[model samples]
Structure formats: structure tokens, C-alpha cells
Target: MEKNNNEKLESMDTFKKLITALDAKLDSIDSRLKQQQGRKGIVKYYRNEDLKRAFGLSSNTIVKYRLTGVLPFTKLGDIFLYEASKIDKILRDNEC
Candidate 1:
């Protein structure tokens, strides 16, 4: 009976260690997935005020740019959103 009790205790200790290691590995994988998502899965946006401050653009000029297809923006109700990637490409293409 004492030997059987010792075996049960050893098994429980091993099981607890295995569970702790599995939890650590799962946490590592979750952190890596979050890092990858931050790099590629997320779509960064710029607001109207962001453009105005970054490029010295007037609100009317931004409107004109959008209307004339010089700039592309997404309109959500009263808000405008510009994709950071598209804006970067536009600037790169137009850079002297």
C-alpha cells in the first residue's frame, strides 16, 4: 500500500510538470502568432488630420485629391480612412 501511494505521487508530480511545460509552449506559440499578426495581418490606417500634418495638406486639397482619384480613401459614415500601405506606395511612386 505504501509503494502504491509513492507511485501515485510520482505520477501526479510528473503530470503537473508536463502540464506546466505544455502551458509554457502554448504561451510561446500564442506570442509568436500575435507578433506575426502585428506584422502582416493588421491593416494600418491614416486619418485626414494625419495627412494634413504629415504632408502639409489642406483639408480641401485632400478632398480634391480624393475626388480626382489622386488619393484613395475609405469613407465610413463621416470618417475617412486611408491605408498606410497605399499612401506609402503613392509617395514612393511620386518621389523625385
Candidate 2:
């Protein structure tokens, strides 16, 4: 009876230790996933503000460019998004 009780207690302790180690590993993985998700990857598009700062253009000029089809854009509600590749191509084609 005494030996049986001792074995059961040892098994419980081992189980608890295993659970704690697993939990710590899971926490580490979760933290790494969060960090990776938080990082900004390659930017494929630009917003109005991005164009304004990068090219030193005003909002009015940006609007005119869109209206004249100088810069093709995608409008979502009120926000406009421009393809980075297209902008680069237009500039390269029009280079002096």
C-alpha cells in the first residue's frame, strides 16, 4: 500500500512537470508568432499620404493625377491605394 501511494505521487509530480514544460514551450511559440505578425513585410502598395511624402505632391495634385489617369489607383470607400509597381513604371517611362 505504501509503495503504491509513493508511485502514484511520483507519477503525478512527473505529469505536472511535463505539463509545465509544454505550457512554457507553447507560450514561447505564441510570442514568436506574434512578433512575426507584427513585423511589416514588403510593401506592394502606397496610400495617398505615402505618395505625398515620397514625391512631395499635394493632395490636390494627387487627385488631379487620378482624375487624368496619370496614376492608376484603386478606391475603397474614400481611401485610394496605388500600386507601387505602376507608379515606378510611369516615372521610368516619363523620365527626362
Candidate 3:
């Protein structure tokens, strides 16, 4: 009877340890899946052509705006990238 009691105790201890390890592994997997799913509700970037289309402005007008710092931009190898918030700010500032 004493040997049987010891066996039960050992089994219970091993089960608890196994559960703890499994919980840790599951938590890791959940975080990795979230990262792989891509970010949601993140800020989106716009390009020069996109800006022109959005504001109905010409290419020259866009270039002039960039040179004059009327719009905030990021230059990526000849491509002018703009942020949505910056564009909104410019429009708000220039509102008549």
C-alpha cells in the first residue's frame, strides 16, 4: 500500500511538471502566430503618385511641394514616400 501511494505521488508530480512545460510552449506559439499574422491598424505609407492622385495635383506640383517642404516625405531611391498623417496636416494647415 505504501509503494502504491509513492507511485501515485510521483505520477502526480510528473503530470504537473508536464503541464507547466506545455503551457510555456503554448504561450510561445501564440505570440509567434500573432507576429506572423502581420500588424493590424498600423499607419500606411503613400508614394508621390498616390499623393498626386489623392490631391489631384500634377507631377511638377508634387516636386515643388517636396522641395519647398510643404509636405513631409521619405526618399527611397528616387521614390518619394509620404505619410498619411503628414498629408492630412498639410491639408489642414492650408485649408482656406
Candidate 4:
């Protein structure tokens, strides 16, 4: 009877340890998933209209910046896309 009780207590302790380790692993996985989701949600490009709205500028102003090399852009066929972060920085620098 005494041996049986000791064995049961040992098993319970091992089970509790496993549960704690699994909980820590799950928390780590959740934090990694959140970081991945945040990366996925970041905008890679901005359309002309969207960029204009974001910067409170007109289409013509966008063109001027592109021509003057003040703003960098990427062309996808005939469509243009500006890096959203870079545009934000430019706007911040110009205080616009």
C-alpha cells in the first residue's frame, strides 16, 4: 500500500511537469504566430489613389515627385506602386 501511494504521487508530479512544459511551448507558438500575422498584414505597395489620399496630395503632385526623383516608385506594367513606408517617411520629412 505505501509503495503504491508513492508511485501514484510520482506519476502525478511527472504529469504536472509535462503540462507546464506544454503550456510554455503553446505560448511561444502563439507569440510566433502573432508576429507572422503582423508581417503579413504590412502593406507592400500603395496604389496611386490610395497614396494620394494617404499623403493628402493630388495625382499631379505624385507625378511631379516621381519625375523629380523625390519619390521612388515601382511599375507593374502600366500601374505604379509606391512603397507605403517610404512614402510615409517622405511625408514626415517634408512635414506634409
TM-score, prediction 2: 0.55
Per-residue lDDT value at 66 in model 2: 97
Model 2: residue 90 alpha-carbon error in angstroms? 0.4
Q: Rate the local accuracy (lDDT) of all candidates.
A: 0.95, 0.94, 0.86, 0.89
Sort all candidates by TM-score, best to worst. 1, 2, 4, 3
Candidate 2 regions off by >4 Å?
A: 1-43
**Which stretch of 10 consecutive residues in model 2 shows the poorest summed lDDT?**
35-44
Clashing pairs in 4: none
Off by over 4 Å in 3: 1-41
Better structure of 1 and 3 per lDDT = 1
Tens digits of per-residue lDDT for model 1, 2-72: 99999999999999999999999999999999898888768989999999999999999999999999899
Best by TM-score: 1
- Give the candidates in order of lDDT, highest first: 1, 2, 4, 3
**Candidate 2: global Cα-lDDT?**
0.94
Clashes of each: 0, 0, 0, 0
Cand. 1 TM to true fold: 0.62
Whole-model lDDT, candidate 4?
A: 0.89
The residue-by-residue lDDT of candidate 4 on 22-95, one tens digit each, is 99999999999899878956777888988777768898998998999998999999999998788888878988
Write the residue-wise lDDT of candidate 3 on 45-75 in tens digits: 8887787787788999988988998878887
Error of 4 at 83 (Å): 0.5
